[model samples]
Target chain A: MNRTITVRPGLRDIPQGRLGMWLLIAGELVIFGAAVVSYLLMRIRYPEWGEQAQYTSTALGALNTFVLLTSSFFVVKAHKASLAKDSKNVVRFLSLTLLCGLIFLIVKGIEYSTEISHGFTLRSPGLVDSGQGVASLFWMYYYLMTGLHGLHVLAGMIAIFVVMLQVRKGKYFHRVELAGMYWHMVDLIWIFLFPLLYILK
Target chain B: MNIAHHEMSFWRRYIFSTDHKVIGFQYLITGLIMAAIGGYLAYVFRYNLAFPAESIPLFGSLGPKEYNAFITSHGAIMIFWVAMPLLLAALGNLLIPTMIGTDDMAFPTLNMLSYWFFFLSAIVLLLSFFVPSGPFDGGWTLYPPLSADAYINTEPDIWKSFMTGGTLIILALALEFVSMLMGGINFLVTTINKRAKGMTLLKMPIVVWFINFAVIDFMFSVGPIIAGAFMLLLDRVAGTGFFDAYRGGDPVLFQHMFWFFGHPEVYVLLFPSLGVIAEVISTFSRKALFGYKFIIKASLIAIVLSVVVWAHHQFIAGIDPRMATFFSIGTILISIPFAGIMLSYIATLWGGNIQLKVPMMWALGFIAIFLVGGLTGLYLGSDTFDIYVHDTSFVVAHFHYTLFPITFFGFFAAFYYWFPKFTGRMYNTVLAKIHFWFTFIFFQGFAFPIFFLGLDGQHRRINDYSAFDSLMSSWHISFRQFATISAIILILSQFIFLFNLLKSLRSGKKSEENPWKANTLEWQTTSPPPHGNFVKYPQVYRDPYDYGNPDMKEDYLPQNKVI
Candidate 1:
């Protein structure tokens, strides 16, 4: 929550620098959109691949989903508090956001450890036990999408920690709202990712 | 107002230059040095093709493997490192701020970072040449399976190293994207929100509109391909499976992601140069730009079509026939907007008192040459013509014809047009004209013959081909000899531009505030602009091309002058 100085008026009243943050998110969305479309298309072409997807731990995925949904809710609350300039409430909600993210990472780490111990590695029959195409393309997507999302999770924590430094200094209070907005976005992405990866199956 | 007499010391004034003019020239010199390397590689491979067994007089003997290595590195350097940086960035960075009324880029530190990142990307690319088994041999496209496995071929390390270069290229692109993005945001804001008090959108120059659209197009289109490059790199060298065909990875998926950026990447390099020619045409002609509104609309249309028509490159790559038909029609339709732009430029000259300056001469050349290139592309766009000629020399020739001339001829026009203002000295017009004429002639002499050879089915990127007919052999040999001879001339002429840079600065004729007698606001500033441009920023009162206004005493009216 960079709470020091706010960005000055930019090219637009919304502020061009602020617009850049949103536009970069839009650009990130498009990249994720391409990857998502490829994922769905791969599934459509190889229906049996779902068999491989089903073997993964649905419980841990659902747990992470709950964690992210809670994180998003907290970040939204933080935005509201910051906008009101209620400093204490803003800090409270932001801490909740951090807590939820930590829980989600721990849940994911456990899921990966269990999967690895069970021998569902990228090159083994544990991936293709159900059928031929099921093991190959299915596990590949499993690793790619989750791996990418998990990396984003790691990135989100770094961003939150940076905001925490700002919070202590009481700098960029308005930027806290902006950072909260980004935090909510990261949580929101997992909401979509969770249903597709775990709950729907 | 003495730009030459800065109180600041050497480091502050020159190295960390905040002057837009200095930064622009910095981009130019860096890109020019890279062009020499890019062109030399093109000659080496071309010579190997024409005389497979023989030694050349200048550079000596070439081995078969080394020949293909040159071809691979040449394409990579020319497309990524050379053409885009030199033609667009070098020229675009220079002209954007000055042509608009801004003194410098919106964020000057980001501007400095863009050049530094470009320097870093260049180093990464150059380092690939020193890697074991030499630089990439998998073609600039870097297709997978061939590019994927560590031991698929004996030369896997080179493919892998080049992929590393591709990653650096993306980083450089991200930096460029930030700079262009900041430039566009600033240009649009300035043109829309900060234009000298009264310069309305309609009253602003067409170049602003063209570059604005180009910058917006670049911001959105760059992300997906950047993500794709990371994916391709992971699969190629890092033991990942993003494009690995046997590892449940889809090769076709790589094609999809690539052409998405790959298609618009064409216009990303082009629209700025086109903007240059469009402005030059109206500027030198001493007339109001003919159909300025229509030209703006035409450029907007080009940007839209660039994104929608990307799949044209994938016509024969096992695409579903229905999708292929959809993209085929798309490829053909893009020509309509381009044709409209051409017509508007030609009509701008109609009934106008034209100045046949060297800049305008190159603009005229760009129009004719790009027209021929555009028309030839229609042949490749047709599904039937595309099937036989997809990867053949025909495709290669078409792109070279389209992009090569634009990079050299069109961008150089912008360079010559602005040299006086940026450097505060007049380039010798005779030397400028001589460089233009000789380079244009040799440019055609080198690239034009490739189209015929392509039609005869000589595929690109191969080292030796004695298997083709004797007619093909003779044509290839003769073209190579001519291309090599002419390439040396092209390389040498660049030094003339460099010499003009040094000589014109110290002793060339002193230039007036408005040297070209044009109506753009940048001209209203001192010969080379100060740290903060304008003595109380001039309020715009007329169109950028209000050349023959009967109310004005002179043939040209400055954009700032009121009735």
Candidate 2:
């Protein structure tokens, strides 16, 4: 009978979920990497972009970077806690990770409103007639890159939340680490985004 | 591996099924239905193109606006809906698990989710046709500035509408990409970590390897386009300047992003079909695959090279001269590995006892047709020649030559080859052969004259060729007439296949477990294999293609056969 068989764990001796996450990371890098490369190329061609970059508040960018890094650290802690089978610590670190994500989005939201109040908007032909081509292009990249990064942050938080739910339900604790790995990727993209969009000049 | 078999209700068994086979059939049926829609759209436009003033039977006269919508949706539906679903999703899902000796996909829930995503996206796409702006008419490329702003479409109806067709198209396609992404992850994870005992990477059938290559290629290449689609959606809805030229955004960036995924996307579609051809050729030739290692290496080389050649499509779109030349060279280089694969298939056929069965005929037909397609692609790959053939029927003909054989011929081959094994019944051979000849002849007749019309300066995407400003020669009209006739016949011939498929399901000759006497792991299980595929875990002992082995008593040695 077909019931007389049992598949060995890891047919190739590699954890399938971890491998899937890594493959996803590579794909995400290519996506975000391509966008960043486009930004860098545009900046290189248009040198006035550096002057435009200086107008943005570097303090907020650096603060978000610190926030993301802290989240990554906590997610790592959650992964370690899960591996050590400490349910309480896993929940604790994951909650911290989720908190950091909220803070990052709130700060990003504040920055966006401030920039809009300063008349740096993404709405259409006004950007071209603003008489600063490089600045317009700079804000376009800033919003697109940061906006995409923020979406990633949101996705990461939801994933961390789900993993936390699973942990609380007392099942599938290994998913905590896999979800953390994805969270770290979100953090890593922001690390690049911080330098390129905010401080590169 | 032994998996516990559970008796499930009809909803769980079929509707929300996780069985790879059931999902494969779901994709097949859905793709066929969509293909009919795409094919009908072709007929509508072709009729209008041929006789611009005349009204058709059921549908009334189609205006230029309607024509544009038809052509655009036709391209999108045929590729995304029909071809991907039929060739990749269906065949890959159905065959990968059985051929690789697995119980089910690594992530069964994710597999189910992929199909549901596809279903939801298809529903959205269908609904877009009924929307106020009508479906997107920006061509399948969805090049921006025009695609970005509804006001730029020049259609009287769309101009007044804010909720444009392009947004709906983008949303539907984004969902489709997500579905494909999920399926890709499953394929990769399953193949990498779920192979049977003693079935190492190299020991896998060429089809499994091809699926692996195609899935990974999809995972790597599809990201940029996904990002681009999101950006384009934002540009349309939120007034972002990603591809809006008035806002200092470069439209060419969208083209780069689209084709970056676009070119590799064709290979992603082609590899699985080619994999099917490899299996069919080896099986019918009664020979081990010639240069199996070489084919794998060539596929990998082609996969790597496919990405760099994306800019060839952009040569006429105002790219740098140096970059154009580089892309032209890169495009030309892709044909080398393909030629190697082609030659290897021919080598497999050399000095072998060949069976001209329905599947074999289709496989051999794939080689003959794809050769023409590949050669003509070389013509279009040159930057100089592309200047003349750009947007012409010659380009259209060349594209049909490339894609039609894969989607039609390869799909039919897979259908016929695996029919008995999956359906547990044999189709009428005579009917199948008739279906093949009619399809092959009519499709060629349909595609070939379009090439001449293209070379004669007949442009594509125009609603009416009879307009005074048209650059078409007088002879081009007759060619169009001929093409129209051929297409009708080609479409009509499909009924024979449909009849054969439906008839074979219940009343045709019942199939044995190994009716074809092939040497694959799938043949070891019962036809229409049970819930848990194998009665005993199959331990692989030899290569899948062991045809005509001198030491073997029988002509073939199954992969799990014990000495």
Candidate 3:
């Protein structure tokens, strides 16, 4: 009864963090995917949504998308550096990714303000009169999708901030890759959200 | 690996323990407490329906809104707070790590966090009852328009109460979902990465495999509902038009999203209990489980098909006609996998050395009761038949027949079966059997007549049939009294269980390592195995059930025993 046994790992054997993160990714995709399907379903019924799409600032949206894509590159670099045990580069790249998240948030804030300033709001007073019936739905999805994605971005930044501090203490460096993967997920969601919200029309 | 070697403070050892078993009991105790609360709510509502003119003691008076609150809270609490935790969280946590020969979960701290979040969710649910608006009365499904309009244009204080209470229920559900998500990750990772030497996937117990399948299904299924909940929350609090038809938001969209999660949630509850019955029956019958591979395939089929059948719940909600037909056929098709599983259980029991232990009685009871439940499902699954029984007592009876056996009988079977191993004490067998008979008979007596009332077209969620003279037939009133009496008797029988459980814990015969001589890894270790579980890591040599093997001298052969 005192004997200790070792299990043989199969082909898919991997770290818990990577496995858990991938499963989390699958669940997230469904959530975002549900919203996407809803948008497409409603869009088919109401072709007039093209008018509501005009209220969004495509330039700002494109800028934020570029920021997220670049940040994802930094996240990949961070994962590579952490695998090499280069704690400095892990912290540096993670900091850069977090910075990109902040920049995207700033650009998003500008786009939202610009839209709201023109009275293109979630509760705009004259939605029924103007017959933006379908267009209002487009904006509704735009705000909800982007807003949810933004929360994910904020979560990613907080995760990286903690990982950065741990890396600075020269311990728990494995967390850097995990945090980077999460940040990349945020970027991945934005990659889907950008064109659907800003450029689909 | 010696768990007893290390000593810790009381707080660290129990209060904030990270041990899987501790967390398992935490889930169990909390779920039971919530069950009691939910049951009391049922008692109150049943009494109201039974004696409409009379005011019950302790809970003096019941208004229409108050009656709605009781029903809403009862459904939500029982399913989310009680059944989910009891089956998935409690049994799943206690068994998976020990059975798979893992010292702890892949992430034990995350496991602990899951329990605390569940605790927080329970507290939030209880708090909703105390709120000024007295919990959301829009029913457990929380169909929108009612749910959406709950927060609008009431008196300022009352409006605030509704807003707070509604949001709390939604937030509590969200938290529970996340908690289960964390638990699901641990289950998947542990099963995939942490099995003992030679414990191949198929060689594992059916209970472990079913739980693994269940967690994965739950992971994918819960997503859309969480999204829908957020949209509903926005509609309620933020004035977003997600479900507000006045703002061009179709409430039916919410139905699609909700049932997308809701229908699969039934399987999430069903699979684990099915797994439990399989183990109990095989172990008692002294034979290998029949159709082991087929059972696995059947579970997988059920999982895949569950997602497509959700619209069956929304058939009469003004959904597209083509969509209704598609969902109807899809729902009917799901019966095939369930039939396969049920048939496998009966086949397992055929021509075997039978032992009618308390656990086995409950297992056989589950099959008998669930068969009625499953057959009634076919009736409701057919679109034409469903149009007649849609919101009637028939639907309620059918649902209880399906869920009651799985949740109550299933959990009780597991409880009696595993009590010896975890507690290192054998319960009073006579008392256990008595509890079973009372529970089974009364449960049937309670739910069976609801079918007749439903056929009479008595709508559900009504506080009192006596109040509705137009809809009330003599049969409806009489059956209400009968069902209510059966329910009271059914609830009282649970006291026999509680008394037996507590009395046995204090004074009972000590148990051996393998009290029932079952051939599984958890039984191979000492009764109440140490924190690291096994003194030596178990290496499996055969499938879990090798009962009455001709080559073996004993009636059962443990998995770790080399042939």
Candidate 4:
């Protein structure tokens, strides 16, 4: 009885909605690619502006990285549990993943507020090599990249919540696994972003 | 294959429809109406051009500011509102669905939203004309400094209208892009996963694959533009200094963003409708598209090339010389794929049972015009040549060749091909051909000399060119004469199309379910298709182009049936 009902098609079969998500993701990856490319070029042109890097707090970013990585573990467990017809564990592990997502967003909000109070506004001035002042390009990129990532976290949380509701209703159970994969991909992006923004000199 | 899950309603079926066919027609209708407004604006401005600040015989003598207003509004409406919408939104709507076997789009509600937003955009655009500052006069590009200060002394502060309208257009294009993306996924997934069982990727019709590629093209290309729109809107209202140079921003940045979308917007307008023309001629003539596989491979190559070549438009914008040369060469390289597709179409017509139908003739006309249009494109892309022709009548001439001929002519070709499927009745061959020739000859008159004038270094957008050497001045005078005559002829050509559509609804001969014997799944359904589309799901076995094969009894294979 347990073996008869699996939520998703075996590896060969891809649900329509899941494939749509992947296609949509490919488009998204290019957009992020561009903004990231712009950031890389701008950063390379100006090297000594590592002062902004000191304030970005590698410890918090590393902590958030661990939280996101750990959340993926719970999401994978939830997917496997859903396939095994263990709805109880599915609910438990998914809730944990969702909690981690909320924590990540909350921490990001705190970081943004702290940076603003420190007078690191997007258009704030910084000293160049000769004591000439220029608007902070690094900070502009900081707000653009991190701010966009923050929005993605909010979106991911919503997607996870929808998956929970769907699992409750016993509808589109196959979709949860795919959604989890996508959520992990979003988390994976931040993993790179964290090291680049916070960990790097 | 399970269409039971995909049924829709009457309001949802046609009017306010999400059906790509309906949406395509809606886009077509909206584009032509905009064209008429835009086209007339050009005529009014031409009179202003021939006799500066003088009242013309018709529509009253124009004022200087009105010329400024007319020139700005006309260029914006024609290029963005008419050309882009007609070719991409209208034609892409109709063809993407039919070429693939999908019953309807993936998200029907979203599809409807796309057209309505386009409608809102057109309204916003027209509304600006009536406002004080008398609509933006800073040309359609709407460069900063000229558009910067609020009317020191001008009617409706129309720059705000430009801002509001331009944003709506971007939103509409975004909506179009999203719905099309969903439709593309459906096409790709259905082609791969739900291909009526027997249809293989190679077996899919050439047109099916073209639209599939178009979906991917718009998806990747549109994002930068979407971000650009937001920034422009921010600059417009939010006091953001994104493009406001005096406010510590870069004006050229706006050009970078606009052209990023603007340049690929050409392919967005070109490829899908060309796909339709490709399908129409091959099927009607009882032949497979020549080099079908290479055309497919070449188009994908084209999509990749389009993304990188956008900087070609900015060669003169003071970029690094090294980067400029690289982009210029890339822009020229992009033409290679276009050459491949054109050669394939011409070869498809070879050694076939050529149908001399109105649609076939229009398709041939498209080939001729597009060839010239495309080949001359080489000039605009080369850095050395571009320096001479940039912003001149020659560049304008080159585009009008490609755009009007393909977009209008190719769309008409599609109209005659599928008007039966859409309306369940045949169009009058006499009227369609009549409309075709008048517009075709007039199009020649309109575009051909404008090329020569461009060679003469005749600049565009001037209110008067009467003082130049007569040889150079002749280009403007001749331009004035031929352009106005062609404009009126093209505008009148629409009536024949409209009359045929309206009359054919009740009066024309009823068509069989699949009159053209097309291989695609749209033909598997009834003439207009049913509410759920089909009672029995179609299973595919043979390719969409099984025509003239000795192994097959019928000339064409239904995409659903086994060989």
Model 2 C-alpha lDDT per residue in residues A41-122, reported as the tens digit of each score = 7788788888877867899989999999999999889888898888899999999999999999999999999888877766
In candidate 3 the C-alpha lDDT for residue B23 amounts to 90
Candidate 3 per-residue lDDT, tens place, B1-563, comes to 45463677788888788889889999999999999999899999999987887896568879889899889999899899999999999989989988888788888999999999999999988888887777878899989888876236222343463446677798889899999998988888888888898899989999999988889889998888888888877666666677767656788998998889998888888888998999999999998999999999988998999988898998789988888888899899999988988998999988789999999999999999999999999889999889999988899999999999989989999999999998889999998999999989988888999999888788999986666775577777777888998998988888988998898899988999888889989998888888878889899998999998888789899888987
Cα error of candidate 2 at position B43, Å: 1.0
When summed lDDT is taken over every stretch of 10 residues in candidate 2 chain B, the lowest stretch is B153-162
DockQ score of the complex predicted as candidate 2? 0.47
Report the lDDT tens digits of candidate 4 across residue range B171-204.
4445445545554555455444544445567877
Q: Specify the poorest-scoring 10-residue window by lDDT in model 4 chain A.
A: A125-134
- List fnat, each candidate: 0.23, 0.51, 0.46, 0.14
> Candidate 2 docking category?
acceptable
- Candidate 1 lDDT over residue span B315-401, tens digit each: 888888888888889888888988888888898898788889988998998888888788999999898789988888788778888
Interface RMSD of candidate 4?
4.2
Spell out the clash pairs found in candidate 3: B394-B454
Q: Which candidate ranks first by DockQ, i.e. highest?
A: 3
The best candidate by TM-score is 3
Give the residue spans of candidate 2 off by over 4 A.
A1-11, A124-129, B1-6, B150-162, B468-474
TM-score of each: 0.89, 0.95, 0.96, 0.86
After aligning candidate 2 to the native by TM-score, how far in Å is the CA of B540 from where it should be?
A: 0.7
Please list the C-alpha lDDT of all candidates, in the order they appear: 0.71, 0.86, 0.86, 0.70
Candidate 2: lDDT of B230? Answer: 75
lDDT of 4: 0.70
Cα deviation at B27, candidate 2, in Å, is: 1.3
